[model samples]
Target: MSPRRIVSIYLPHFAIQRWRRRRFGPQTPSEPDPIVLAREGHHGPVIHGMNAAAVKLGIEHGARVTDMKTLVPHLQVEDAMLEADVRDLRMLSGWARRWCPWVRVDGKDGLLMDSAGADHLWGGEAAMLADIRQSFGKAGLTARAAVAPTIGAAWALARYSAEPQEICAEGEIAEALSLLPVAALRIDQDTITLLKRLGLKTIGALAAVPRASLARRFRHHLALDANPPKRLDLAMGAIPELLDAKLPDPPLRALRKLAEPIEDIDNYAQVLGVLLPDLAEQMDQRGLGARRLALTGFRVDGKTSTVEAATSTASRSTAHFAKLFESHLERLDCGFGFDAMMLEALVTEPLPQSQHSLSGKIEDGIDLPHLIDRLAARLSPEAVLRIVPQDSHIPERAERLIFAGSNTDAAWPAHTRLRPLRLLDRPEEAEVLYAVPEGPPAQMIWRRRTHRIVKSEGPERIAPEWWREKSQTRLRDYYRVEDSEGRRYWIYREGVPDDGRGGAPRWFVQGLDA
Candidate 1:
C-alpha cells in the first residue's frame, strides 16, 4: 500500500467571498471597492474579516470599525455572520468528499482530506490539487491547496506557501518546512513573538535548537498548538495526527440521464416506468419501503419540475407506485424538455416480507391502502381524510380528521352507549322551555326554530376532567331526544340550577344521531 497522503485546502477570504456570492452571483468578479465584515464588540463594531481590496487598504481584522472608517471613508461594511460561515464551510467539506472518502473541516476556513491512494483517479497529486483549486474558483472562492505525507505539513504549506498549489514529496517535509516562518507551525501569536525574540524566526532555526532546551521552554504549555516542538513533530511525521472525517448519509435516489430531452408526458412516464423498478429493487435490498417518493425532471433550460407521491403504508411495489404517480404526471411542467430525471425516496419505513396467496390474489377484502393512495393522488392528499378516534369522553374531542396516508393502528374504543353519527365541532346553544330543571327538555329552541320533545331518554351526567379543566367548570347532563318531526339530537345542559358554578342551567345541542 502507498504511504498516506493528506490534502489541505485553505480559504483565506472565505467569509467575505461567501457574503459576496450571496449578494451577487457565484461567478461574481472582484470589485475595486473595499468590503469588510464587522461584528458587535464590547467597545464597538470590530472587523471580523476583509476582502482583498480592504486588506490592500491597510484594514486589519479585529480592528474597531469606527477607527477603520477614519482611514477609508467609503468602506462597504456588513454585519458578520460567523455561524452561517461555519455551517457553509461544514457543508462544503462534506461536498469535498468527491475527491476522497475521508474529508474533514479544518479550523474555521479550511478543509482536510485524506487523499491517500485516491490521487490516481484524478491523474496525479498535481492534477488533483489543480482540480480542487479550479472547482473552488468556479464557486467564486479563493483556494490554496497543498498535499503532503503528513496532515500538519499539508496544512502549513496550504496556508503559508508562496504558490497557491503546493505538492511536498514524501521524505521532503523538512526541506519544505524549513524556510517557512515559525507562525506556519500554527502556534499562538504570543509564542511566535516569543520565538522571534529568541532569534528563532524561521522553523529551521527553531528546529536546530537542542530538544532538551525547547522541551524545557514549553513543557508547561498545555495546548498542542501552543507548543512549537509538538507541532514540528506532527508536521515532520514524527507524531501521527488523526483526522476526524465527516461522513454524509447515503442518498436513497436513482438517476437517469436521457440521451435526448423528453418533451411529452408519455415519454416521461416511460422514463418513470424504468426508474420505479430500479428504486423498488434498492428498497427491497434494504428490506425498506418508501412512505413518500419524489420524481424530479431536470429540464434542458436548467430548471426542475417535481411530482411527489405518498403511500398510506410503506410500499415497494413498482406497479402500485407507478399507478400513484400516473395521476400526477400531468402536473410536471416540461419546460424546454427534460434532459435528466431522478427518483428519490424521501421517507421510508421497514417492511418485512409477507406470504402472498397462491393465486396472487389479495386475501384481504379490499386493498384499502392502495385505493386510498389512488384517490389521494387523483384529488388532493389533504382532501382524503380518516377520522381517528381520540381518547376523550367529550363529544367534541372524541375524534379528529387526519390525512388518510398517515400510518396509525389506534382502534376506536368500544362503548356500551351509542354515540352520535355526526358530532359538532362546538355545541350550539339552545333555550329550553316547559321542562323540569333536573329532567329532560320538554321543548327546545335552536337556530330560531322550535322543537317539541316527542321522546327522550337520557340524563347521563358527565363530570369535568378536573386535571384538565378549572375547578369552576360545570358538569354536563346529556339527553338523547326526538323532536316532533322525528329529528334526533344529542343535547346537553351545561350546569344544574343553583349548582353554584354559574346561574341557571344553559342548554346546547351537541350532535345529531343518525
Candidate 2:
C-alpha cells in the first residue's frame, strides 16, 4: 500500500434526510417546500431544512434561519440535528470499512478509503469500484472516483477530473487533473477565483509561475516554490472515487395539469386525461405503479406545492391518481395561476400478484399505512403518533412525543420500570392533613380537593438517575392510592426524608389508569 496515496469522499449537501417530510401537503393551501437545517455532526450532515426551493433561488449555506425565511417569505427552516448526522456518518464509515480496513469518513457525506493494496483483493480497482457501485445500485446511490499522487493530489483529480464521476488510475492522474483548477485540490473558493484572475486557470498553468513572484501576488506562494525539488504539479496515480446520491427517483412519474387556473380547482378533475397515459406507460416499463405518488404543482411564479398520496394497492390505472389527488388538489390555491403539475410515484413496494386464499385474508387487511397517510393529509402527522416511553426515573424526561414518520427508535426501553400515561409536566404539591410516617398518605388535599385515602399500596421507591446533571436528579417514593370515589391516582414524593440542606419534600401525581 502506498502510504502517500490517500482517499477522501465528500458528501456535498449531506443533510437532506430529516427534512424529507414537509409540513404542508396537497390537501392544504398552496405553499413552498420547506426544509429543516441541521448542524453537521458525527453522522456527517443532518438535513435540516434550508428549503431547497429557496436554495434554488440562490440562498447559500449558513444563512441564518430567520434571515432565510425573510429572504424567501415562504421558507421553513429548522435546527439541524448534530447527533443524528454523526450516527449516519458512523454507519456509512462502517460500510466503507468493509471494502478496506483503513477507511475514514471525510465529512458527513464523504468517505475516504486507502485502497492501494486492497484493490487487488477485490480483483482490481475498477472491478472493485464496479462492485461498490453495484451494491449502491441495489440500495440506489451514485458515486464518482479518482486516483492520484498524494492524498491531496488524488483528491484534486477525483473531485475535478473530467472523468471524476468514475474511477481513475494512478498513472493517469496528472493528465486527467491537469485541466482542473487549483480549487480541485480541496482549496477554498476565494483562492480559486484569485488564481483565475491571475491567469492560472488550470493546475498546469499555475505550476509554471515563479515562486518569488507568485508569493508576492497571492497566498498560493507555496505552490510556486522551486526549492522543494518535487514540483507542485507532479501528479501520480488517479484518485479513487466517492459516491453521492440524492433521493432515488422511482421508475414511474404521474402528472396532472389544469386547463384554466381556478381557485376552486374543478380543473384538477378535468385534466387527468392527458397525464395518466404517460404515467401508465412508465409503470408498464418499470413494472410498478402508484403505491406512492409525489404530486407537485408549479404556480405561474415558479413556486411549487407538493403532496404525496399513497394507496394500499399498487395501482397503475388512471382511477388511482384521480382518487388520490381529488381531495388533495382541491385545497390548492391557484394563487396567480398554476402553470404545471406533476405526480412522481415512489417507494413502490410489491403488490399482490393475484387473489390469495381465505386464510391469507385473515392475515391481510386494508393497508394501515394508506389509512395513516389519509389521516395525516387531513390532520397533522405529528397528531397521529404512539406513546413511547424512555428509560429515565425523572418524570419530566421519562417520555416524549415524536412524529411517526420519522422512523425514530422510540421503543419502550427494557431497562425502564412501568411508566404511567398521565405524567405531569411538573410535580404538583399539596398540603397533607394526615399521613403515615413511612407508609402512603392517609389524607391529603390535592388540586384543591380533599380526599380521604381508603387503601394505599406503595413504597415503590425510585432514585434519581444521577448519571445526568445534578439538577435533574431525584429520589422519590411512589404510591398507588385508592380513594372513596373509586379513583386511583399514582403519586410520588420527591427527596429523601433525612437529606437536609432545607430541601423540602414535595408530592406529585405521576399518572392515571386507562
What does candidate 1's lDDT look like per residue over 430-461, in tens digits?
99875455987899999999999989888888
Taking all chains together, each candidate's TM-score versus the true structure is: 0.55, 0.48
lDDT, each prediction: 0.90, 0.60
Q: Which predicted model would earn the best TM-score?
A: 1
Weakest 10 consecutive residues, lDDT, candidate 1?
Answer: 432-441
List all candidate RMSDs to the true structure. Answer: 12.1, 16.9
Model 2 quality (TM-score): 0.48
**Shift in Å, residue 400, candidate 1:** 28
